[model samples]
Target chain A: MMTGAAAIAAGGAGSARQPRNAALPAVIFAIFALMPAFAALTAQHYLVDTGTRIIVYAVAAVALDLLVGYGGLISFGQAAFIGLGAYAVGILSAAGIGDALVSLPVAIAVSMAFAWITGVVCIRTKGVYFIMITLAFGQMVYFLATSLAPYGGDNGLTIDARNTIAGWPVLKNDTAFYYFAFLCLLATYLLCRALIASRFGRVLRGTKENATRMAAIGFTVQRFQLIAYVIAGGIGGVSGFLLANSTEFVAPAYMAWQQSGELIVMVILGGVGTLDGAIVGSAVYLLAEEWLSGLTENWQVIFGPFLVLVVLFARGGLIGFCARLRLRHG
Target chain B: MTATLFFVQVLNGLQLGVLLFLIAAGLTLVFGVMDFINLAHGVQYMLGAYLAVAFYGVVGNFLFALIMALLASLAFGLLLEFLVFRHLYERDHLDQVIATFGIILFLNHAVRMVWGAAPLTLPMPDAFTGSVLLAPGQLYPVWRLVIIASGIAVAGGLYLLVTHTRIGMLVRAGATNARMVSALGVNIKRLFMIVFGFGTMLAGFAGVMIAPIISVEPGMGTNILILAFVVIVIGGIGSIRGAFVAALLIGLVDTLGRSFSIDVLRLVMAPSPARTVGPAIASILIYVLMAIVLFLRPAGLFPARGR
Candidate 1:
């Protein structure tokens, strides 16, 4: 798989060496795969639901990593893509089209279309300007959704049931949905990894490192970036579709900037540029969020300083931190 | 009647613009000088409103509470700079964004814990509480006019300071060519602190002034923070003049857009759809403007660091 080369692709841009070992990613995936059975054994039915939720968000986080980590494009609007995807499903289901056959493509297409249109304008700006513009566009999505009176407005829309898989009632079972989401996550992971290892991925990496130099060497940097942006949006759409199914509801809050920030936080927490780190990061973040909120209502007070400390100390996120730990013991 | 309403909306826009300048002034200065992105800057504005309310509860004098709150928020900003932000100045933008974002979460929640989630209020001072007649059947609140005057006064004062003073020269120099200024033996760290403190104080001042009109609550900074970001991006990073112009432009555009979007849309479409589309467009009017500005001028309208 040329693990070192792929890690270097992400590492060199972040200026932090991404560990090349496949162990961490495998372990995380193993845990994800075993989650439903573990939940059933423990009789904690909600654990399956939690596992499904994590898988859904992890999908979005991975796509976000494709942007922030691999491409060096810090889009603060990833959640807007997710919102577009979910709304596609929600709106379609309301129109009596509840089959995945119809909703899936609609969800993915709408998000990609949005990503393409916004990417054209967004890729023109750089640095903080890029962040602000993405955020502004995300806000545009949020306000638009809130004004959707027919679709429930500020309160959000509800789907009565899961979308049928080709007219088969396959996704109605919680266990089935869990595996369904797990498979989707796997597909997204493999797709992102494949993308990062391809020539297109290499050019994106080259552009990230030195766009001017790449441009000098005859690469249309913005066009490549726009494509990556659109692809990531498509993946975010997948996450949103899963999320809508799991919750059976979608709201304007799906597109909120805060949700976008959390996705970025999740990517950073796992270790930017590590595709599996995105999955690990969201799982860790959401689990911690659940546990902490249980103990204290003002959990953010503890969590906030914790994030500050992580930024100050954890240079390459949890993955980097663990690599250093292994080296120390070795 | 239509003319008076339009005039009133213009003043409302100017008022909103003035408040934005207060927040953006500090944001642009810190960003321009330190090259640090403080996502928590909005919380500083929220803290200002909260502190003002607390001080008013104790002191019972609007003027005294305002001064005390500004000083308190300034001190707090300095404390944050000393503790967390100073370390992040040398870090990458990603780390800076995360750390400050964490601070925003902390403060917004901490404020919730302390003040409760319910919105609080700061009453207008008795003297300025009255409304002044603008025209027949048109009366405007005097406090809003005070906000505009004070905002302009701050802008004028900042202009003089940047143009005339030695420290201001260092700030301008720092913004344009920071490394060069540092090589010439200026204590850049101290300069950063001074600018950061001043910016924080201005944000706090704006919050105090506006607290009377709006409900003071947790996470108030989040929404306004986005607006401040928009203002700075449009105005050009590191340019106070840019902030002033962009702030007013956004304020007027946003306010008037919200007020008249439906009427404008009605001209091109049926009233029913127009009613639905108007608010959505109005909400994004500034963003659309931001996109247009970025498309035409990627570096912003007034790039202070002239390439």
Candidate 2:
């Protein structure tokens, strides 16, 4: 059932292709890549910070889409992995292992281990239960972090310095880190695109559409889904790493369920199951939040209703809304 | 720990358990009947407490305030159902979660805007103000006793309603298969409204009742909501009896663990290490219990749905 869904999705991709618009996303990305440089040149430090946040969260949102949209796994604990990654960096740096190479692997390993254990129990459930169980696991992790009094606990940990690459302060400079993040985002996009097109990806997508049929066809549905979850988790961990460095602090609040909900909003607001949509969603979401907060302290009072309207009226989110408009115009 | 301290905490745990049962009962029923997960159910609880406070300010009588609060909560819940929840019944769990989460955000902030960010307190009724001595040097408050007695009574009443009443049969039937009940000309929509409204009221009732003892504040319901979810999952969804039992178990375990975890750990390890490890373990005890339950019985201890 899922294999057929994949084929149909692939067919849609082919039919929906427009030659002129093929490079639109790339052009948009290039503009985004240059945003920080423009900010730095203009001496807009706050802009640089906001841009870095967008890139980091965008990376996490894209990873989230891979699991929720493509793989049919709705996780409410993506922030847990991100927090784990952030904590990995913090704990290691505190222990004097401040190298990017060491910290990155440690983050990935910690997140992967957590995902493996939690995903085992979480995968057995489906639908609403799946969402809640994932949430419960996330809360469990948050509480554990809060109890770590030795490492700041509820007060959170502060990094002494940003991570260095081979003992050079390559990542400390705002422009360099922004460019590094952009490169990572680009690589992540390409890698996710490749993975989704592979034979493995096909099987994974199959399980999402119809697990029973896929199982009947002798595919190990659980294994594929688990791999997808781990991959998503690892990517989320990368987002945490960026977030910690960006904020210069890591807290249990990073993994709270509210953060997870915001990540999902980013996924849906962009349009689910689309790689580019994740980036678009993140950019739109974070920008709107930043803009709204500037307008009022209680921006969510208005934003909440706006979200309800979006979910009800806009089926496929902003991308779908735009697509409909263009079709009518065309 | 002294026996008096132990006994006092146990009673406290029981009281907490009862409040959880009231909230969880309605939650599990809604899920069982509609196949819906309402994260905003906690907001209903918060609203209940807020309404109680408002009503009390007007009537200045505990009974009048309680009744008004319950009615207000029912109306608010039905309003939400009519406006937002009705559209979501057919949607996936993710959509339900997100929409409900949005509701939580809106309501929490709205309450803050109206009630301020500080915790609000409902004064205990003068009639239930004094303490009754349970043991030597152990005096428990009358209001807490009232909560315990009322919670158990409600639980008993619910058991009777579900097992022996005509509506109970329909509820059980609905839990098993909602479509089948609808096919039987049971007016599933009306049933849904009753179940939803009743659940909302129960949660609200819990909030109002506990307001005097605990801080009545914005976002007060979120943590408790998660705890209620754990109870329903452990008790087996759709089972009132399961919710009742699970709520008590969790209340006892969590309350007792928080109080005695360090003491328990001290027997096996040094005091310093125990102090650190104790609180962490106590916080996670319910989850560990849940994991164990899931391993043994994935559907929970008494699932409404059969194998």
Candidate 3:
């Protein structure tokens, strides 16, 4: 059942030997690490703000790749966990509790709890049904957020101040917050890389490659998938926590299906299953979106066809395309 | 609830159900036959409303506008199939989902560009303009009843078309096993085009029928599109019967839950908490139903593919 395009995309370190550019990830990180300096040099505070947003989304997209690319789970509800995380911060803060130590754990725990409950139900189905059920769950969360009037409901809630880190307002400074987000992104990426190279990762990838075979070999496929889903949800929660702090606002729109779709697009565009690719995809997508919308309000009219053409012609996404180009030239 | 109010709600629920069925019928058929997930299906419904409005401006008659809209929708759908979707049928579901999502984004924005961002409306036809008495002092809008009638009629017609005709047989066989059907000398591509076109038209039809009541706006399809997906999932993918039953059930549950959840909750909980929780619960009721259905029957109620 493996198509040529899928085969090419799935050829991460496991199948094909690399072309000896292992420093690609380090280079990307180095670039991100130096972005703040670049922003400072350019004296563009908006660039830092936009970079922080990209880093936050990159964290979410990387987590999604863990499920979609490696675990063979296409969850349309990943944004729900992010929303849960953000709402945890917003609700606790609104109730006069703005400590990151308390709110961060609550955010992660709540999202994981949701992931566990919904994952248990969602893992029962496969293929299109899985996609639809995840979407249903996401919409349910979105509506729940809209109905929470005490927390500002559909109008959304704005925090008076960002979460204090151990009674310190280190995050109140924009540069400091950007660095914090960058660190979170780095941690998330490294964590994903480690997870994908572990015994657990091997089993998850094996199940993805052939679930029936894994089942026949006495592996409970659902358990591994559920664990992966929960892990992804936790990471998504972390991103959500950062997102709330970044904007100092939490809205139901954060968990809208469109956001989920954009996350999926990021994964696909960056080359699904590729951790660094997800990061790059987020950067490209957000930057393009910001740049294009500035050009015309109807930018999606152009962006949409571009996506279609990419899916049609660019089988493996940007990373895949880069790989092909290197192979041709080198 | 009062009997009249309950009856009126039920009619509203039925109207909503029929509209869902019209959208889901085509959606499920495409999924069943081609295994293609068209996220753009909702935009087709939006297009239908927009086309109806455009045609109405020219024809100045609702009936003629409806016919022209349907025809235009069919042609537009076929064009999309020819241009974009035709290449996607062979790709995986992820590819189909992404490509169709792109179509959704394009069309939604395209409509906004062409029609402006303002909400547009079509007046109810003169023939179905007023309210009709169902019981003493229980009057309902004639147009809503008309929508319900037409939806049911479309469903009945779809049932006949899917069950009786040669194309229907091919569709059934394809849903059961596409490769087997194609191997039997069936032109799967042509079958796919036909199925895609019909699904697009049904979605458009639902949009046109509901346009008079709801504001015709850009991105109108995205909300209902999700509902249709829920219906298809609950009904069981690839099963028209499943879609019909699920759509109506969802319509009733969603409508009734929203209308009476607070009252229902107040009996067990305090009024304040009930008020806060009721709408949230009501909005998620169908999704909860879907989760339960999937847990109970993973393949859905009437899975076209055998267990």
Q: By lDDT, who's the top model here?
A: 1
The alpha-carbon lDDT assigned to residue B127 of candidate 2 equals 96
Compared with the true structure, what per-residue lDDT tens digits does model 1 show for residues A24-61?
A: 77888898899888888989999998899899999999
Rank all candidate structures by their lDDT, best first, as comma-separated numbers.
Answer: 1, 3, 2
Q: Alpha-carbon error at A159 in model 1, in Å?
A: 0.9
Better of 2 and 3 by lDDT: 3
Is candidate 1 or 2 superior in lDDT? 1
Q: Write the per-residue lDDT of candidate 2 for residues A175-210, one digit (tens) a residue.
A: 788888887788778878788889988887778767
Candidate 2's DockQ:
0.38
lDDT of 3 by residue, A259-326 (tens): 99999999888777677778988999999899999999999998899889888887667777788887
Per-candidate DockQ versus the true complex? 0.53, 0.38, 0.58
Those runs of model 2 whose alpha carbons end farther than 4 Å from true positions after fitting are A1-24, A38-43
Q: What is the lDDT of every predicted structure here?
A: 0.90, 0.84, 0.89
lDDT for position A90 in model 3: 95
Predicted candidate 2 versus true structure: per-residue lDDT over B1-307, tens digit per residue: 9988999899989998999999999999998888788989998999999989888988888888999999999999999888988887666555566678778878988899888889888888899989998887778999999999989999999999999999999999988888778998899988988899999999999988998888889999998998899999899888898999999999999999999999999999999988888998898889888877875677888988631
Ranking by DockQ: 3, 1, 2
DockQ of candidate 1 (2 decimals): 0.53
- Per-residue lDDT for B1-307 in model 3, tens only? 8878988999999999999999999999888888788899999999999999999999799999999999999999999999999988777677788889889989999999999999999988998999988999888899999999999998888889889999889988988888778899998999999999989999889989999999999999999999999999889888999999999999999999989999999999999989989999999999989988998998888988642
